[model samples]
Target: MGIAEERITRLHQLAHEATASGDFDLAREYVRLARRVAERNRCGLPKSFRRFICDECDAYLRPGVNARFRTQSGGHVVVRCDCGATKRYPY
Candidate 1:
């Protein structure tokens, strides 16, 4: 992995840790920083990282904590962030 990718991965871990510790603002900062790094490096964010972040509010989702996860009958998974942004992914 390149330096940018490594930094993003580290930031992802840090964000997860911050969220677990109940410091959501710090987690959001980490998420935004990681995204900026990826943009500057012209690299796509990791799939796991992309799925866990809200596109509208830039919040790191923690499933039931700040996001709701559901499976629809249409063969897709729906993730709704606390900010009311919803994302759908095929299963």
Candidate 2:
């Protein structure tokens, strides 16, 4: 993998390890670093350019309720489904 990809992977690993160890403070720091690296590498597309996919219906998420971003370990999005299921998309 390229340097950016390797860095991103390391960031995720660190964040995961921190969380698994119950070191929330360290996890947050790792998450912050991951976000910065992702932003710097232009890995995540802009909101307007992003294509939301519903994990349940396999359809495009309609907008508002389907969108939520978290600066967690690795990137994650919480999507509220019409079926009353809350699905998390992680990358």
Candidate 3:
């Protein structure tokens, strides 16, 4: 796999471990790291999947598209595209 993919996988593993160990903070941190790697790699959610990516920006579309709350877990995560555009979808 590519470096970004590897990093994302590692981060997921770390998050899982942290969650199992009751380390919500650590898990959240790992999630953040994964997001960063995904953003850097310009990886976006596939249209066939439950997510959508912005054509202008390769951000990962997540859930909570129009929620008032500001929680990161269920919200759409996206990366800024070259044209400074972003997309969102249900996580």
Candidate 4:
């Protein structure tokens, strides 16, 4: 893979590790940096990372902690971030 792609992946990995270690703040910052790298390279964020990145505050979401997930009727899944952003995804 290219250097930019590798950097992006590394940042995402660090973000995941930070979240796993109960450091939500670092995880959020890592994700934000990863997004910047991706944008500078004109690339898209990974699918796995996309779900965890809050669209409103750009915070990294840890399910049940910083984010609340709800599966509603009518083929909708909602993710509510601590920043009061509600995102709906069609399942």
Off by over 4 Å in 2: 45-91
Note the Cα lDDT for every prediction shown. Answer: 0.96, 0.54, 0.50, 0.87
Q: All candidates: CA RMSD in angstroms? A: 0.6, 12.1, 9.9, 1.3
- Per-candidate TM-scores read 0.98, 0.49, 0.49, 0.88
Rank list by lDDT? 1, 4, 2, 3
Please give, for residues 6-33, the per-residue lDDT of candidate 1 as tens digits.
9999999999999999999999999999
* Best-performing candidate as measured by TM-score: 1
| lDDT of each residue in 1-91, candidate 2, tens digit only | 6676678677666655665666756755765665577689888522321234333443334434334434456687666645555666566
Model 4 accuracy (lDDT, Cα): 0.87
Between prediction 2 and prediction 4, the one with superior lDDT is 4
| Model 2 lDDT on a 0 to 1 scale | 0.54
Q: What local lDDT score does residue 82 receive in model 2, on the 0 to 100 scale?
A: 53
Tell me the tens digit of each residue's lDDT in model 4 across 1-91.
8888899889888987888888988988988899889889999888877988898787888888789999988889899999999988888
TM-score of 4: 0.88
lDDT accuracy of residue 31 in candidate 3? 64
Question: What are the per-residue Cα lDDT tens digits for candidate 3 across 1-91?
Answer: 6877777766666665665666756655666666677777898422342132334332233323311223257675444333445444455
Against the hidden true structure, what lDDT does model 3 obtain?
0.50
